[model samples]
Target: MAKLRPNLTDVDPVWNRIRKEAQDAMRNEPLIAGLVHSSLLHHATLERAMGYRISMKLASAEMSEQLLREICDEAFDSEPMLGQAVRADLAAIFERDPACHRLLQPVLYFKGFQAIESYRVGHWLWQQGRKDLAYFFQMRISEAFGVDIHPAAKIGRGIMIDHAHSIVIGETAVVGDNVSMLHSVTLGGTGKDDDDRHPKIADGVLIGAGAKVLGNIRVGHCSRVAAGSVVLSDVPPCKTVAGVPAKIVGEAGCDQPSLSMDQLLRATGE
Candidate 1:
């Protein structure tokens, strides 16, 4: 069973609580002291620690850890929004995931959070016109985390991906704020038409496991896409959709479907 740590109301409190958790972890298990020290205790701030952690995880034969760390540091330092997004992401996981006891879990153990942070650095690189470096980050993240999010994909803050295995977000995909999804979700395109392809998932949307949303369709805000559904068209705001070539089954049944994390498909009595 997972032991819950100290409560955190916001990003600042989260960092403080994570430090406390790290201290406890070191005292309890000395074997991982060095790991905890390097990953969590060494840095002065969450962004700095994240820079070190992601670089260490994604470093390859082509790119050394020191170089990767420098790049990540530069990204974190230059792009303030990256850190903001990261904080939001952490908060999203802590609040939404039942298994997550502390903010440290997402920083250290969650591949979804780590992958998204790495993708943020990649997106920064892309914005700076360093396409090759961005692509490199994309490759490393996919290889290490099994979550293939294109560097060009525009993802907003406070996103949570549960059991985030085999998740794919295409280049033209746009995921909005406070959105949540489970494993094996694909925001992909229908064909080779490269321009403006892939799905646009709006704020507070909840996408279920193994759901495939194809093409340049809009999934409106606060919507719910059921598990194993194949969505090829636009979904209206606050609606629940299901089945292959998914249809509107019912209302979202709540204001924020993502926050609720409810995948229940109440029969519409159609």
Candidate 2:
């Protein structure tokens, strides 16, 4: 059994910042006060707020929001990493995305962030052998966010899925920490080789928009997959690949391609 990590005691500055922002928004826009209060101010911690937000977004006629909130709360309480990951993701978006100015945007507005958090709860349920509930989460997330991430897909911390539309991660896909990808990315299988047949993306990899990385291939650490590229083979570390069948076009250009969010090829590129 994995050890239950320590519960957060110190007041999270990120949560405080979010609350402050929410308070300001309430004053600035009187019309949205109700929405702001229910989503941000009503909850105490980031985890609780996230749970409520996700449950509210993904709830259906069949599943009540109250029940889903409990499930999400349980997941956040049991898995401290989920809370940590939320903070990391919030930070990642604020740091990497040029459009994101405040910490409140991802939590209250961004579908990508919400989808990933929902997937984390589903992933926790998957680990707990609640396959049915996990599948339900996958279904709702796909319907609500247009992102289909399998619950069994192992994604690490600090993930930023920009636009996040049409993002499909296979059941066996393993994405490492601090990875960033744009819209229409797929970490899918080559065919029906069900057993462990998905891409293993290393840390700090930047997968550009409309890129499809198929099969049980390894995208090495800090590599960049250029937009609209189809990668069928393994990518070496710190390299840039572009084309239908992606080739090492050049160096990754920066140490952290994901952090840089730089998709443009350098002048020296072949």
C-alpha lDDT of residue 157 in model 2: 92
What local distance difference test score does each model get? 0.92, 0.94
TM-score list, all predictions: 0.94, 0.96
Candidate 1 lDDT over residue span 52-78, tens digit each? 999999998999999999899888778
Candidate 2 pairs with clashing backbones: none
Model 1 error, position 128 (Å): 0.4
Cα-lDDT of candidate 1: 0.92
Q: In model 2, which regions exceed 4 Å deviation?
A: 1-10
Q: In candidate 1, residue 98 scores what lDDT?
A: 97
Clash statistics: count for each candidate: 0, 0
Give me candidate 1's TM-score against the actual structure.
Answer: 0.94
